[model samples]
Target chain A: MEVINIQGTDDTPNVILDKNNNKFEISGRSLPEDVNMFYEPIMDWIDGYAEAPNEKTEFNFKLEYFNTASSKIILDILLKFEEIVESGHDVKIKWHYHEEEEDMLEAGEEYADIVEIPFEYEAYTD
Target chain B: MENSHENHSFLDFAYQLYRTMKTNEISLVYEGEVTQDITKTFTSLTEKSLAKSEESNAVQRKVFNVMVECLQNISKHADALSEEEDERRGIVMVSKGDDCYNIITGNVIKNGKIPGLKENLEQVNSLDKKGLSDLYKKQMKEGRISDKGGAGLGLIDIAKKTGSELSYQFKKISDEVSFFILTSTIRRNN
Candidate 1:
């Protein structure tokens, strides 16, 4: 499958989905004006990746900030990984937040509770 | 002499506006069309101002997030007062109190939207934190994004982050339009 790499901007996050190198991560801020237009293709790629996926998939979400619209899209992306898990594959989400950002941690916990997948949190310092 | 007199009066008006802002603890104010580029500029400017004040990281993020949502709400939902004007013009102001920061925005909206918006705001204001969280999750799981690119979750999300009730008012502007003002407060100690 082709790798999906998108550079981050002031209003969008950087995304990299590569099954070849076993790298899948999304990080940075996300507050795009047209969220559906920005996230549709990324969701499609994930759907394709789920078809012939890796034995173990670890997706990282290291978001600095995201608006409510992007938050919904993030959940959809996580749910896709949940599907991968239900298909007899191992999937773990590494949720990264800055040490000072308690709300981000809580956000990850909330998503973990909603989705059936396992989540490991990683806190970092700037 | 006429040009000098005009310049003197302009400076006086400017100084008066500056004094009002200072007295109100307002750090930023913008009144015009709110596009994506304008939203970006406002957020960045607020970010810089918050940094200079030595606010906590969490508070800075909350203020920034609320400001973005408020600005985008205007961009998506604001209606021009007249048919000839097609811009989403609105006013946004950021003020700091001793204990909290207030994000205030106002825009013209159709009078027909008043009832539904009122009910929504009342419903959101009535919820506690847990209820708001549940509503947010439910909406995220089920709510469809509108043609205007809203997921109907902005208010709920703002309530969740700030842990404060959403305060709002609608002033009738004409037979067909009203000015809607919304203020979200974030406590610094939180």
Candidate 2:
């Protein structure tokens, strides 16, 4: 599959899904007005990638902020990874948040609790 | 002479409104059509203002999140007062109090939607933090997105982030339409 590299905008996030480079990260804000239209292709790409499967998939979520609608989409993305794990593959999520953003950290914890995959949290400072 | 007098009255009214906003410590007040571009502009403006005021990053993020939800709610769900009017028009205001910042939004909605919306807000308000968290997860997993692109989780998420009861009011404008006002508060010290 081809790599998906989308530059971040004021309301959207930067997404990079490259199997060759071993980089799968989504960072920045996500509050797109048309959530479905903005995320459909990314969801489709993941679905296609789940077929071939990497040896050990490590996904990173370095989101500064996301709205409620994007929260649902993020959950969906996590659940998709869980499906890959259920099919006898290794997948881990690296949840990155700012040290001052307890809310973002808690959001990561919530997502970790809801999903069956392992999540490793890392805090950063500006 | 008559036209000049009318112009003078209009200017006086505008000055009075500006004074009221300033006295109330209203940082931003927008009353017009709510669109995607407008949402971006409003959030960016608020973000800059919050940062300038020396608010903590966490509080700024919370305010930005709540404000986005409020503005998107208006853009997605606001109803026209008449059949011919198609634009989504609403009013959004951000005001600062001693301890908390308030995000208030108002828009016209169909009368038939009042009961369901009221019930939903009441249910969201009645839950504790754990209950709200559970509800939010459950809804995220099971609830389908509406035609308007809502995940049915905005209210719950707003309540969760604010950690306060959501206050609201509904005023009947006519037999077919009513104006709905919702206020969500975020404490500065939180």
Q: Scored by CA lDDT, what does every candidate get? A: 0.93, 0.94
Poorly placed runs, candidate 1 (over 4 Å): B1-9
Model 1 Cα lDDT, one tens digit per residue, B1-190: 9999999999999999999999989998999999999999999999998889889999999999999999999999999989899999999999999999999999999999999999989999999988898888899889877878888998988898999999999999999999999999999997
- Fraction of the real A/B interface contacts present in each candidate? 0.72, 0.74
Q: Across residues A1-126, which tens digit of lDDT does each residue of candidate 2 receive?
A: 799999999999999999988899999999997788899999999999999889899999999989888999999999999999999999999999999998898899899989999999999999
Q: Superposing all C-alpha atoms, what RMSD in Å does each candidate have to the true structure?
A: 1.5, 1.0
Best by TM-score: 2
**DockQ score for candidate 1:** 0.80
Kindly provide the TM-score of model 2 when superposed on the true structure, using C-alpha atoms.
0.98
lDDT of 1 at B174: 96
Best by lDDT: 2
For model 2, the stretches where C-alpha displacement exceeds 4 angstroms are: none
lDDT (10s digit) by residue, model 2, range B1-190: 9999999999999999999989889988889999989999999999998889888988999999999999999999999999999999999999999899999999999999999999999999999999898999889889877778899999999999999999999999999999999999999997
Model 1, range A1-126, lDDT digits (tens) per residue? 988999999999999999999999999999998899999999999999989999999999999999888888999999999999999999999999999998899889889889999999999998
Top DockQ prediction, candidate number: 2
